[model samples]
Target: MKTLNSYLSETVINMKPSGIRKFFDLAANMEGVISLGVGEPDFVTPWNVREACILSLEQGFTSYTANAGLYELREKISEYLFKRFDLQYDPAEEIIVTVGASQAIDIAFRSIINSGDEVLIIEPCFVSYAPLVTLAGGKPVSVSTFGEEEFKVNPEILEKYITSKTKAIMICTPNNPTGTVLSKKELEAVAQIAKRYDLLVVADEIYAELCYEDEYVSMPSIEGMKERTILISGFSKGFAMTGWRLGYIAADRVFARAMLKVHQYSIMCAPTMAQYAALEALENDEDVLYMRKSYQRRRNYIVQSLNEAGLFCHMPGGAFYAFPSIKSTGLSSEEFAERLLLEEKVAVVPGNVFGQSGEGYIRCSYASSMEQLQEAMKRIKRFVQSL
Candidate 1:
């Protein structure tokens, strides 16, 4: 019989297990463990949205959808993008419904990258990008963003990393872990660089609706960028519908066709009921506004609590996480996280899980209730004092 080890694809064999998942697995069975490590929203799908899904199922909408997604759902998404972000996309040709934003990222990489192409990723990024790039036979080149700079991508640093072999740059604003939202000026600078190099831009805007300050901006919305940018977003973050597994990519028709081909062979289409629910989410503005306000309240609470606990943290303008420097604890991020879980029954993700530059920091999600945030902060403070 053939050995099981030899049966795996080389890419699958070589990929490292997700760093976030490693600790999460351990935390799962531990009693009384209060976790702030997950990036998902704590809210359930809104009643109206859930009802839409149920209604679809009752109406026998369980069959597979069109490869590009249901035309009605795509139309709703197109209208939503234009109404919210002033961006226009031809739903029939320019959009592909995906399993989630995660799948969109994967399919986009597959569509554009060949073996050995380099993908420029901003550091302290979402954990999946590097491994996914590797799986697509692309090399991931990380450019570190410092907390001192409010985690904005530096144009000079980006310039230094560019080469002829670089196929694309993956940009995530209202970023995971750090919760930093890229400013309009910063995004324009990135656009200029992409324009100069003729590079494709993969802009992940899943957290667009969560911005606490200025309105969210799409890279493709900038002049000269729409054709070159592949925009990835979905209902997951904005609508508190993580379980819906519905996301869509808006790109040039050419790239969209390429991704849809891969998506056809792989996922076929996003879930039918979920797509109907997402259609409702896009048409409803108040649901988005309500969730945004709730997250903002939680954001303020966590930032203040961390500061009071003596962990210096930047106030996040978007997303649901607060990344705080744990240098005061005189421990590496892994050590700090491990000890916190062991001693205080509190769990947060170590920054090192994001990338090497995340060494002395830890990420806490404020998507939980205020009471949980308060308790976690108190436990953290006691743990720090003990250290």
Candidate 2:
């Protein structure tokens, strides 16, 4: 009889289990748990967007779309990018709708990374980049950023890790876990490094519309970087459409075509109804604005409350999370998270899950209601005092 693990791919065998999953499993079984663990938005998809998707189904638009996604959705995405970021791409040949930004990352890695290539990933980062790079036969090299820096990726950090074998760099802003958004100056610096090294860039800007302080900056918007950058974004974060499972990547025609081939083999197209819903979202900007304002309010409340509770937290410029330092409690991030869940009934993610740079921090998502945020903060304060 074959062993249960015998059939696993070597890469799969070597991969660590997701650090986010264990806490979620514990949170699921506990009664009355107030969870700030997940990075999902609490708002429902705007009625107009949902109605458009239903309309499509009613009109018998359930068939599989083109491998590159529907032409109309792609065109809308192109227009949206131009209007928001001043970035331009030909819809027909430069964009491919994906299952989500998650799939776009996978496709990007598969398309460019050959065996033994190195991909630079900024940490603490979104969890999937390293695993996906490994699956594509590339090594993930992490560059650590600090909370004091607002987790911005510095040029020196990029320069330190880049080598001849480096194939691509993955950057996310506003960043998950830290809620750090890169400034134009920072992005230009990154662009310079990319140009100097002749490196491809995978910019994940799913949280672009959720910025609270300044405007979102895109690597592609910098002069001369658009051709070398693959812009990955989706409606999930901005439009409160996480369940829609729709995303897209925009790049030069050459890279876009290569990604399309991988996308065709893996996921023929993004969900048909989701593509239609996302198209409607692009046409309507008001919904995104409303959600953005709501998240900003939540961000402010959580940051202020955590600071008052003796936990040091930097006010995030974007995204719906606050990464507060828990070092004063004399507990590791994992221990603090575990005790907070068991004793205070509040669920948060341990920062160490993102990378070693995340140690001594815990990520709290404020996507829940204000009342929930208030109660969670009170519990957290009580827990800290007890410690």
Candidate 3:
């Protein structure tokens, strides 16, 4: 009989579990532990979107959709993309509904990467990017961005990483861990470099609508990037629809067709009820604005609170996370996080888990209520003083 390790493929054996979820699991067994570790939004899915799903279920709409998804849902996603970002996706051929933005990300990598292709990844970035690129038979090369630059990738530095083997670059704006949003000027530079290199771009814009100080720009909207960009987004963050697991990919026909082939075998289709709910979500921008405003206030509160408590954090222009430096605490990020959770009963993710550049920092999600934030701040302050 073969052992379990013997049966596992090298790729599956090599992948590390997500660091964010690890702390969350530890915090769960403890009572009254206030957590800021997970990236999920705190808000409930809007009532109208939930109602649409319930209605669809009541009407017995329970079957697999066309491999691409419901034509109407795709049509609405196309219209929404055009109106919001000036993107034109041909709903029928250019859009494919996905399980969540996560799956869309995975298949996007798989569709484009040939074995040993190098994918330039901007760090410190989302944890999944490297693992996903590895799974796609590609190597992930880190391109570091600094805190002084507000975590935006500099184009001049980006030029140094390119080689003939580099096939694509993955970008996330309104980024996780650090909440930086790329400006139009930054994107223009990136677009020019990508155009010069003839590389594909996977722009993860899941937090596009959550921008606070500046309006978010879609990468595909930049000149010369339309045909070569694979855009991934979802109803998770902006719509508070995490459990719905509905997302989409918008690419030109060639890439979309290839990705759909993977989706057909791996997922078949997104849930039928979730599609109706997402259709309803597209009709209600008011709900999104409401959540964004609330989050912005919480962002203001947490950033200020963390700084006042002796942690230095830059002003994150978007997303609900506050990436604060813990250097003064004289502890490694893992030591800081583990001690804080055990001592203060406040949970957060260590920054180094995001990438090597993330050492000496921690990511605190302010998506929780003001009450939880208040308590979490107090506990963290006491913990720091004790050390």
- Predicted model with the maximum lDDT: 3
TM-score of each: 0.98, 0.99, 0.98
Per-residue CA lDDT of model 3 for 40-70, tens digit only, reads 8998898899999999999999998999899
- RMSD after CA superposition, every candidate: 1.0, 0.9, 1.0
Residues 170-277, candidate 1: write the lDDT tens digits: 999889879999988999999999989989999999999899988888888899999999999998888898988989999999999999999999998889999998
Give residue 168's error in model 1 in angstroms.
0.7
Instruction: Evaluate model 2: give its TM-score.
Output: 0.99
lDDT of 2 by residue, 337-370 (tens): 9999999999999999999999999999999999
Native-to-model Cα distance after best TM-score fit, residue 312 in candidate 3, in Å: 0.8
| Error in Å for residue 277 of model 2 | 1.0
